[model samples]
Target chain A: MARPLTLYYAPFSRASRGLWMLEELDEPYALRLIDIRKGEQKRPEFLAINPAGKVPALRDGDRTVAESAAICAYLADRFPDAKLAPAADAPERAAYLTWLFYAASNIEPAVMARANKWDVSAYQASWGGYESVIDNIAGAVRRGPYLLGPQFTAADVILGSMVRFGVSAKLIPNRPEFTAYIAHLEARPALQRAIKIEAEYVAQLKT
Target chain B: MARPLTLYYAPFSRASRGLWMLEELDEPYALRLIDIRKGEQKRPEFLAINPAGKVPALRDGDRTVAESAAICAYLADRFPDAKLAPAADAPERAAYLTWLFYAASNIEPAVMARANKWDVSAYQASWGGYESVIDNIAGAVRRGPYLLGPQFTAADVILGSMVRFGVSAKLIPNRPEFTAYIAHLEARPALQRAIKIEAEYVAQLKT
Candidate 1:
């Protein structure tokens, strides 16, 4: 039997990336929404599940996985039928891992640095300052309509969400490439479904 | 036939983590050490291997994988005989991925922020600031002799390297847990071998 996938997520958090990935895979999952405003994510129970007390954690049967990027990679591998990732030994596997790690290591930090106005020395910082990171990402997008050139892997789920958030947060300028790239992602039915579901869930909070 | 693993590495850099992993795996690989001091890493030929112009890039035949954390995970998966990772179907797999990502996402950035004196609001920072990240890591270490408890998975290779470097750099204080953990890791034959080889390589450069 395929194990059940449970996602402990919340609105307006990085959990949205995992939520979008779940929607993309069209897998059956129980969404245990933890309200950040209500401090549910910090509760003793959630803390037991994730010591970091962060969202987008997955409970695959008895096991739990945290970190949005890791969760995305795990689910894609777990549910190979979704074709979210190339086969483990596929030639493209290397590129897939590269972009996925880059999203967490390079893209996330770069976004945070820009969003928080942190000053990182260009020589020491791995991302080489926000401007360089941004240019690197831009260069990647200019290479294609998708991150892996043609096939949209699970990397797109995280990277796309980041680009979309960057656009909305005004952290990344709406250059033609970024704008066009986001449009392509938004047009996906899975992303649309996830966004709508999240919007409805968020709306319920007010009621 | 299994493909030859070509590792682009440099001693004393994050590439050391990959070298430690290679030792742990006991895999036969061709070591192409890039002299970072000679600016070999930034050369156009090296840039083709990694646009970031960083060391620790692994080439498996035609496939290339970069980023220390990614390389660790890739090797763990590729060499399933090593049993260095939890099976993809195991619940502990999530925990495995979590620590690996956390090393890159939370710990690395937190250490950099402190080392480079990048000032930013902790709440606004994705890592929730260096203090909290360190506290979280210390708390994790308190859970064990290893990141995943008694059994040292590839996550240990990733975290152990960071802990060792952070302590040496004095970015992380040498607390009881930190010191004990480093001592435990350093005692490993694989780690010792890697360090011995790197030490000799560095010594050669001085002559």
Candidate 2:
């Protein structure tokens, strides 16, 4: 048997992107859900894996990778068959890589600040505040159907995941631009599978 | 002649990382210093190139890459002769890619929040607040000399830049572990040259 890849995740958390990444890749992996509500993630054992005490950490063979975007980046590179990540020399790779870092570095943080109503100067914040981020993202997708032109790569998976979170949480307004972008990626079969899995997980939590 | 790589830089800003990245690669790149103090980065021409109006944006060939870490990631892959990034299949690459995203995605935001004294909860913040970000970084470096075992790749250029920013800004204290880790990377000649250049630029401003 292959050294099984394991992801310590929690539904509806950032780890959903990691889970969704694995789902998109069609890879064999085990989902080890860490219950944040019950304080399971804070346990010593969990900290041993990720001192940050966050989900979306992955145990692949002997190495471990954490952070949602990081996990997705790793998976894209690790599973070359998925072609989720562009090759090093591909011109499209520039936009692909930029969007990957941009999502986590700018979009996520800015959205959090916006929802919390923090008084940050949009110009000072790397993400340029929530509205600027929305504008920047809209401008990118308006250029094409996906971030990297026509390719619906892992960058989309991560960005789409954040977009969905933003919409559902009402942090990102339901602007026609964002809706259209999400609609484009949500139409993918692999993404649908991951959504179904999360819906089931959410239902289980309710019952 | 080589569609010269140009970095839109500003002394003491995140652009220093982009400069250091080019310096480390031994690639000749033009420095287009944007005087953020004079609001040059916000100039219509500059904004036309990068709407974020941030320093440390890069124009390589016909491609433009913004976001400090993104520029570093792009250069690492674009100019592979530098050996800054690991092969796609290398196990260490996972940790490498993870830390690159971590620096920009978490450490930068968390440090900014701390320095500004933003009334943000550590738990709610995406970077998990300042202290957690510091602790997590310490744990990663504690494992080895670098985030990716022994190799000093482009990941170091980005992370080292942030570590230096953190300690200098007093946002991240002069913890012995951090100081030691930075000492390991700060000893590099390329970094030294970049620092010297920034110092020169700062001196010019004084006059």
Candidate 3:
């Protein structure tokens, strides 16, 4: 048995992506829910775990990995048995790293900026707003069922969940490429399990 | 000889950091300067290299990798002889990945948000703003000369450049920890070469 891990998660937050990744890894882990609705994530104790006070923070033994994409990348490498990453020196590894950071540094911010209708100038913004962010992803995924093609990696989880949320929340235009890419993710049994588990967790919150 | 690589860089852009990384790797790479002031990044030919129209894009052989942190991480692993990354299965590996993603996903965006004074609600913004981002990095670096301690990695390059830019721009506070961190980074030989090269590139624009 591996060292036990804990994922401090919230159903409605980006933690959903972390939980989805956990399910995809097929590893034994514990989930401790942080109720974002009640402002539980901002509590003192939770802030100690993540000063940013975000959910989807994972603790492996004494080490803590926060930020959703970081957690996903760490888990992929830690559980290399899952083979979600290419070898360190593999040629494919460069694109894998590029897409993961792209999602974190660009896609997430662009979606939020668009979702909130923030006043952002395209040239001034690093992400250049939602249209091009979407365009970049679509241009790549148009070649694939996966961002890396042929093999599903953690990059897929990052891109798939972000696009899924954007489409579902009506923040992103329902383009054919995004629509099909999200549908492909939806069919994954791991994502289905994550959805089911969160439903149970959220239902328990009401009682 | 290793495969020849090209760095599509611009002096005023974040591409300076990418050039820094190439210098750190101590490998020979040709610098193809893209003049952002002339709107070169938005030009048709440049768009073919990075459809997002971002600088700091890299072309290794025929594969293209954009995003500075991603490029740093890729080059670090690609040239493992540089000893910039922890061994794949090392205990330090998770923290290594965590900091790299933190720089891209958290520190970089946090600086931009603070600099632009975006109206970001703390909980809604994944990066939690500049103060918290600085706090997180300070907490880690106060324990070190580098993010992972006693040794420098590509992650330091990312954090170092961002803080240097942030403090110089007066966007990030020049606190004890940050000032000390920037000073430590300035003492690095690789960074010195990057700065010298950038100055030369900039001087050419005036002629």
Candidate 4:
């Protein structure tokens, strides 16, 4: 028998995004908690798995994938039965990928800019600055129940996590569309389970 | 006959990254220039194609994909004959996607942090700081030939463009690996063509 797919995770961190994805897949995946609070992720042992020494690196067989969006995109494609992603030939695939990249490439930088109060010119920053990024995101969520309309895919897992975190932390604008979108995402049983799992892990760490 | 896949582009801009990928694909792709210098990308007409009002939005049939990395990933998968991406089942696919997201997510943000001289904490900014990002990049290119061994995929287009830009601007370290990698990438006829195309476009604009 093959060893189960595993996620190198840490509770309350970006790794939770991967945790949510794993739950959504509803597949049996092992969790190896890297005590980020103790900087376990930066340790050599974990560094071997991820050179960047970041948590949320998913290992399956001998292959390991890091970067939260990449992990979600990888799993979604690897497990087609889960229907967490569009088929490569599907028309929606282009939009699907666009959102995934947008979440990471555009959203994250914009969030950081806002947090750090950086005076980033729109031209200099490929993300086009925080206000435009939020406006684009707001426009995206406003059009639907999800980023790519009716069907929810891993793009949501990637982008939704950022929006959810941003909105909750009072960093992203508290627009009605975002609030509604967060509510919609929060209602997911998989997300609920992931939240419970993180809480449980944190509880155990505390004990 | 189907309309040729169109790339909404701006010479000497991030869109050039998409142009390089299109050239690498060696397919008939139409270029619709959105002059960034004239602020054409910000116009409502261009915004209709890409809500973010950014150039490098690729339009195939009715589907339009933006974000340079997304466009490259989409094209690579869309045209498998180009061999610009690993097949979904291929072992390298995970790493391919990892690098794609890494270039966009990790690399771009790190570049911004460096250019702006922002005091970004590794914990907060998530690119792990500019030094670590460069170290990781240098390590990858040092392995040589290409990002994923012998196969040169769209990951290179996305990341290479950034690395090339960084090195030339002296923003990235003057490491031997990166310098050699840029030289290797520069030798590609497709990149040369892309460069020539940009130069020609600029000349036309000047006239």
Tens-place lDDT digits, model 1, residues A134-190 = 776777777667887888888888777888998898888888889888988888899
The chain B TM-scores of all candidates, as shown, are 0.95, 0.93, 0.95, 0.97
Cα displacement (angstroms), candidate 2, residue B152, comes to: 1.1
Model 1, range B1-207, lDDT digits (tens) per residue?
Answer: 654898898888888988989999967987888998888987999988987777789999888998888898888988888988988877678888888988887888888888877775654555766876777788888867888788787899988898888898899988888888888788889999999989988998888
Cα error of candidate 1 at position A130, Å: 2.2
Ten residues in sequence with the least summed lDDT for candidate 3 chain A: A116-125
Q: Which stretches of candidate 1 lie over 4 Å from their true place?
A: A1-3, B1-3
Which RMSD values do the candidates have, in order?
2.3, 1.9, 1.9, 1.2
- What TM-score would candidate 3 get against the native? 0.95
lDDT of 3 by residue, B1-207 (tens): 645789999896778889989988878799998888888988989989888788988888877888898888888888889988887767777788878888888876677777667788778777876787888888878877888888899888888888898789887787888877888889989899989999998899889
Give every collision pair in model 3: none
Q: What stretches of model 4 exceed 4 Å from their correct place?
A: none
lDDT string for model 2 (B1-207, tens) is 754699999998888999899998877889887898898987889987787667778998888888888899899888878888987777787778778888878887788777777778755666776777888888778755777778888888888887887787787888887888898888889989999999999998888
Q: List the DockQ of the predictions in order.
A: 0.70, 0.73, 0.70, 0.87
Q: Give one digit per residue, the lDDT tens place, for model 2 in A54-109.
A: 88799998878888888888888788778898877877777787788888788877
C-alpha positional error of residue B36 in candidate 1 after TM-score superposition, expressed in Å:
2.5
Candidate 1's DockQ:
0.70
Docking class of 2: medium
Question: Worst 10-residue stretch by lDDT in candidate 1 chain B?
Answer: B120-129
Q: B8-100 in candidate 4: lDDT tens per residue?
A: 988888999999998998678789888888889889999999999888899999898999999999999999999999999888998898889
Better of 1 and 3 by lDDT: 3
Q: Give one digit per residue, the lDDT tens place, for model 4 in A1-207.
A: 755699999998889999999999968889998998899988999988988888889998888899999999999999999998989999999899999999988887888788888888988788987888998999998977888888889999988999999888988989999998888899899999999999999999999
DockQ of candidate 3, scored on C-alphas against the true complex (2 decimals):
0.70
